[model samples]
Target: MSKKVENLLRDICFRIKVKGREVLKEFPITPAQFDLMQKLYFAGEQTMTELSRMLGIAKSTTTGLVSRLENEGFVERKRRKNDKRIIIVVLTKKGEYVIDKVIFKRIEFVEEVLKDFDNNSKEVLVSLLEKLNNSVKRRGG
Candidate 1:
């Protein structure tokens, strides 16, 4: 039983990583870009510093990512109404559309992966994942 559990864990992790990369190939943006988009989309508009801090990336690296996102029309900078010096990054309509599509595809991939799972198993899987997420946060991942 222990060996079975270990195999299950290893296979689950490896498959998710490989399958995520494989399915993401159809998208124009890299995984990093999608990650940033997700952060911006979920968190709303943020300054470069805010995004950098959230992503745990350097300020200059965030700047380049923002630049590429802007040029690709995935994101745009909006000047703050209160402060002209601070620019808030906002996702454009195109950005939102791409994000939605990418998310749908990713979801489909997950659905495929878990198609054989029973309802109880699915719930357990989600619970375990939540625990894992908490662990990562605790470890400052």
Candidate 2:
């Protein structure tokens, strides 16, 4: 891609990220909390070390986030049946409820943002995003 095209894409993505964070301020969860919940929701229970690695955050920071979520009744920590020394994080029913609402609102926001786009443009944008995501994953892996 040309420099101008790359710059334009970067700016658009940055704006979307900033706006999304701003919008989430009104919700019960912050962007980072939503990220953790989404990861746990899809990947199932994980150890603190594993979650920290997956999130690329330090264990101390992960601990704080986990603590806050637990206090909110959105997450629960449990000792493994086989390993008493290890603790895994699990999502509570409250977490599931909040996540469902958050996800639906997020999708709604995106839909509102794209309402001006024509059908063909919308399809092309979605296809390109999927292709780009897959390509990045393949290259990274």
Candidate 3:
């Protein structure tokens, strides 16, 4: 039962992600860029090393990603105040705008997908998902 539930959850997540990519089709950003931007939007500024670790990618890969984002005016890298060796990245105004639009589009798509659900059903779903999320966090997932 647990394995079935896990598989179902993975399938659901993958579908949602694919739908999100579809929603981003009109935008210049890719899913990878969106994921990185989303993290910055929620997690605030972070060093390149930290971002790489969090994204489970190599430092060089993170640098390449940041380079692309920077070139597109989506993000900017800054040297730490006291430590020039440390590079912290932050989203630019353009980056924020793209992220906001992408998020709104994703939410709109989800609303359409969930339109058949009643308010109570939606609320219950949210509650259950939150519970599961909290449990996952507690278990270090």
Q: Rate the local accuracy (lDDT) of all candidates.
A: 0.83, 0.82, 0.85
* Per-residue lDDT of model 1, residues 43-106, tens digit only: 9999999999999999899899889989989899999999999999998998888767766666
- Residue 34, model 2: lDDT of 71
Each candidate's clash count = 0, 0, 0
Candidate 3 per-residue C-alpha lDDT over 12-77 given as tens digits, one digit per residue, 9 for 90 to 100: 878767766675676678777788888899999999888888888898988888899999889999
**RMSD each, Å:** 3.9, 2.9, 1.8
Q: Tell me the TM-score of each prediction against the true structure.
A: 0.71, 0.76, 0.87
Looking at candidate 2, the ten consecutive residues that score lowest on lDDT are 18-27
TM-score: model 2 vs. ground truth:
0.76
Better of 1 and 2 by TM-score: 2
Clashing residue pairs, backbone N/CA/C < 3 A, model 3:
none
Best by TM-score: 3
